[model samples]
Target: MAEERLIIPKKISNRFLMMIGLGLVLLVAGIVLMMIAGPAHHDAHGAAAATGHHATTWYERFLANLWLNNVYFTGIAIVGVFFTAVQYVAYAGWSVLIKRVLEGLGYYLPVGGVIMLLVFLLPIIFTGHNPLFHWTDHSLYEIDGPNYDPIIAGKSGFLNIPFYTIRLVLYFASWIFFAWWLRKQSVAEDLNGGLTFYDKSIRISAMFLVVFGVTSSLSAWDWVLSIDTHWFSTMFGWYVFASWFITGLAATTLTVIILKQNGYLKMVNANHLHDLGKFTFAFSIFWTYIWFSQFMLIWYANMPEEVTYFRERMGGYEDHYTWILFTNLFVNFVFPFLVLMTRDAKRQMIMLKLVCVVVLFGHWLDFYLMIMPGTLRGDSGFGLIELGTALTFLGIFLNRFTKGLTEASLVPVNHPFLEESIHHHV
Candidate 1:
């Protein structure tokens, strides 16, 4: 089994590569559709637009969708490393067999970093305008300039491009470095077969947790929260993390199930699935708690500043967001809670996959609500651009992820937990 896994079956590896071709075709088709449809397409969604913000154009809508996926998938990729760090520091044995899966997922960090950088940097380079983050527009800080905004200018110290870029680079560099170091140590442990690598990994994991705890929140602020420019939430960072964690958990769980269905991870079984299921179920509630807490606090206070975020989504973008808002709650919270409630259900692959797919797409909509309302200024346009961008990201992510799986032996033979994991019973 170890010998076989050392080289992934072509069946699985090629399957993901095929997604790349399919994704490219769809992406090109989408762009062509946009060009033919012209800017008039989005004007219909004007169909409606917000009062205080600039009108959204078609390509800007394309860029907004691009940025949306960048943040959404980046979180899923980072949480892979976060999950691995938690298992190591907590001395978790049950996850040993699936650690490679987590690592494979984390491998996307470097690529995701590049995509995020492009989304942020390209518009500024070509047009000197920040299509995504309104605060990033330099004119907003031009004290005497007509476009000057005192509120946005006040945030200039932290939101300035140089500082923001530095933080963005800092986050990806830190995440990528730890992800590489941990994977290196894991492979080393597999070769040497000893406690030395394991002990070293725990120390590395502890350091990483500290780094991640700080960066996760700050990155969320820089990437998502800053988009609003005016609204702030004390729990926004945590809210983003919760959403990222569950989406990653679902992706990880779904990958394991897929691998098992394809005859990989022979050592993993129902007990492991249950554990993953419990993680998905618990975090759904946790995310709902964060969602409600953020909402309730704002709604209760009805303060203009804090309430503006929700107001923009519910009151202003109500036409497009209303159904999506309810769907987000049902799929992310209500569905997961009730469906995964039974012990047997958690152990069942069919049920887990259903919930995982729903959670994955549900949170994408969650991020859509976060980004589109602000960027499009109430004109919510969902079409080929959104679908195409998402498909391209999905294909690229899966391709990178599956290729990583082939790099290491799926089973961590030298792991101290290997024996226990093989016999692991819930």
Candidate 2:
């Protein structure tokens, strides 16, 4: 079979842009409402001001959910580069057919990194509102102050504003640098068609994996886990990593399937879908393993500090977030485990797509559970902030990923394994 260039239809392109427009409208609207909802003000007693009005409650929830979606989407993009790097390092041939899709998805990291820096970090540090990071309230570090938090202060050396800001910058800079370099070399290979860039990619990928292994975990610690400063979990890093990686896999798989359905990537077929399905399935279980391990150990230990995390999540909310819990576990774990367990299921385009969608939303809820408990406590409920923020990032991702596809040949023109990928079959 001969390989041909993939062309995205104008209809699809228009649709993507329209979605982006809608997402922007929603994001702006959500932001306005959040502003109206008001900044979180803690009373002298260290308790959040009793904003008796529902709108004020909406503001806090919106901020938390917005931050959650931003971090979640960023995680997906970061793992996009990680996935591609791993495939390069492993010399994997089967994925060469869909490498462009993965690369396009990876392009959104810089966008997300900027959002985190400008929206989340700058505000926490300069504004000193400290709504997001309680540690940002200098009063907490005061030895005898009403807002004193000895635990957070104990970890102050590492969690201070200056060090935290520097690490955030370094992490994004490193990730963006590696992702840019990898794609640059790959695109150069498409034109030069030699082992020069290919060999370079392998070496960079090897180095990237090592750096990524550490940075990815630390980013999770800083970005997500730190929300509940008192709660600590040794497994938290790996658990979140599994969630982000699997979600990235599902996003990649879905994009590939969508392209194939639209009559592009003619060389890709059931074998490719099956491999993607396997990843989705395998990692869904891996996510479950980490989830259960984290929960079970905390439950077994029954220590006040450790159990506080689950206690807040289970008991903090007015409605008890029990359903979200079930949804996260069932959709992310059980559905994928059962639906994609069969070989035929993995090959079926419809099933694979369905499972991918499930995994994506399930992990979104997972991040929600992780965040809301600490920030909004029992007040967190899914509303415009959740819906609009999700749409906003979803639009940003589609627009960016699609734009990336247009900039390059949808196929890696000079990949040594291109032939093997073309002939790949189960």
Candidate 3:
């Protein structure tokens, strides 16, 4: 069978404009709320005075929202490249049909990397405040000062600004290089047929995987785990990888469905969709196992330092955020486990799409739980600010992905395994 080449749609519809408009409105609203709430925070005095009372304000919550979202989107982008690279390493044939979609999803990496770096730096430059990360307080390292913290001071060698910034640069630079290199080789392969580009890609992909395995963990530790300066978890990195991996699976599944509905990816059939569904189902369970292991080990040890992480979410502010744990587990694990357990349900496009959407939001809430509780404290509440900010990022994600799709053949015609992917079946 001759492969049909993909054609980019000449123009995006008015619905695309509607998406942009809605994103702008939500973004503006979120920014307005954050600006208005700015005065409530006492940056000069920090979250606590010399008297040792913990206080939080709405601006801090806004900062928390920004930080959480930056990492969330970054994870999504990283996992996109991760999904593609893993397939390349394994010489997987079934995924070649929708590989372009994965590449498109990865275009968000450079964009999101810049945004996250700026968000991390904003407090230090403009306000002389570090609301998201309290370790930025130099006084904490001063042994004689009122703000002295023995724990934070001890970790300063690894957690200092210079090293942190360097790692940030290296992580983004490395991921961007791999993403760009792979995409370039893929398009080049189309122009000049043969396995020359394909052979280079395999070697590059192997190197990328080794680097990603290490940096993904380091990045997770730097960005999210450091939020609570006192707590530590050896399992934190793998746990984070699982969350975004499953979430990325859902997003990829949804994108394929959308493309097929619009008369693209015609080669992808029920069998392909079923395979995607199985990944979603299996990873959901894998994520749950990691989630439980992390929680259970900490709970059993009963150490104040480690247990405080959960304690804050459970008892702090009357359990405002505790319910998120249940919701995350239900939507991500239980919902998929029960719904997609049967063979028939895996091939049902509508049900799979719905579950994918649900799992995406569920993991967003999972990240929210991880970051928000550390900074928001008594001020923690889910409202327009949080919802609108998420909407803004979602719009950005979609806009970039759609624009990226237009740049390449929607199907990689020269890929050696295209035929296998086209005729893929259980």
Candidate 4:
């Protein structure tokens, strides 16, 4: 008998590469458009210097804002891919069936790194002050500066540009290194078919999880929470974690179902779907709990600083703020809670996939709500730029993820828990 060959399918890689190239092109084009539009200050002050309908440049500002928001949202999805990989490594589950799907997703980490680097460097590169991060205002640290915010000044040490850039580099480096190592080990198992590969993964995973937790928390603080420099929450780290965790699981479930439907991973049956659905269901509730806890605590305390966050969201943008709260609660909590609570729904591919899609979009909106209100401010209507950017990233992600699935054997035949995973129920 001849040994089986383990070659990755070429078509999948080609398709993925093409989509990735398209996404990069769009991302770069969007950035250029934003740069051309210049800062909001120029538009406001130079209105008299323009002509005709282009005089106000309202359309240009709108496009710039939309593209910028899309950039941030797509960046979140990129983070989602990274988060999924971390969880897989941490659990060391027999997710061999979809491990390549995750590895494919991992490819986006470097892309995400580029996006993040662009965002972080944009202020300096373009000489445009970052509205999202007040600490970036170097003049504020100067002795005679008049535009300095006291709060930002107080935190200058931790939030300085150099420190911020260093932390971000470290975070991206750690994630990329760990993701690459784990993928290498998993693929090596296919060639070696020995317990040594599994042992290596186990040790690395244990160490990686500890590092992952710390870095993830800091990254969330640096990336998201710091947007509102005045507001601080001890639970903010866990709050962001819960959102990403649920989103990552939802994405993973969606990928699995899509592959299974296409006849790629036949070994993953309803039982596997059921297990994935359960995680989606449980995490929905958990996310709601953290959300409410954060909201309720702030509401009850009613401190000026704390309540200001919600007040800006709920009072200033009442319609969107209300809609976001309702949609997040319903799609992430209510719908999934009702649908996935049942044994039949969990086993039903259609229903499970439906729930997964809802959860994924819900969390995307959740991040949107968290970000846009603070960043885009008054002109935050969802439009073509947002949708286009999302489609661009989704197309790229799916292309990469599917190719990864076809790269390796759908099932890890040598995995110790491969049979257990196939038999997973409830």
Candidate that scores best on TM-score: 1
* Candidate 1 lDDT, 1-426, residue by residue in tens: 253274556875676667666666766776676567665455233455446556556668778888898898889889989999999999999999889989988878899899888888888899997788888777888889999999998888898888988999999999999999999999898898889999999999999999999999999999889999989999999999999999999999999998899888877899999999999999999999999999999999999999878766675654666667788899999999999999999999999999999999999999998888788776666666676778778878887787778888889889888888888898
Q: Which has the greatest lDDT? A: 1
After superposition, which runs of candidate 4 have C-alpha atoms over 4 Å from their true positions? 1-96, 318-320
Q: Write the per-residue lDDT of candidate 2 for residues 294-319, one digit (tens) a residue.
A: 99999999999999888766644444
Candidate 2 residue 10 C-alpha distance from true site, Å: 4.5
TM-scores, one per candidate: 0.95, 0.92, 0.92, 0.83
lDDT of 4 by residue, 376-395 (tens): 54444443335446656666
Cα lDDT over the full model 2: 0.82
Arranged by TM-score, best first: 1, 3, 2, 4
Model 1, C-alpha of 342: deviation from truth (Å) = 0.4
Name model 2 segments beyond 4 Å from true. Answer: 1-6, 9-11, 24-58
| Candidate 3: segments with Cα more than 4 A from true spot | 1-21, 30-55
**What is the alpha-carbon lDDT of model 3 when measured against the actual structure?**
0.82
TM-score of candidate 1 relative to the true fold: 0.95
> Every model's Cα RMSD, please?
1.9, 4.0, 3.8, 5.6
Q: Residue 191 of model 2: what lDDT?
A: 86
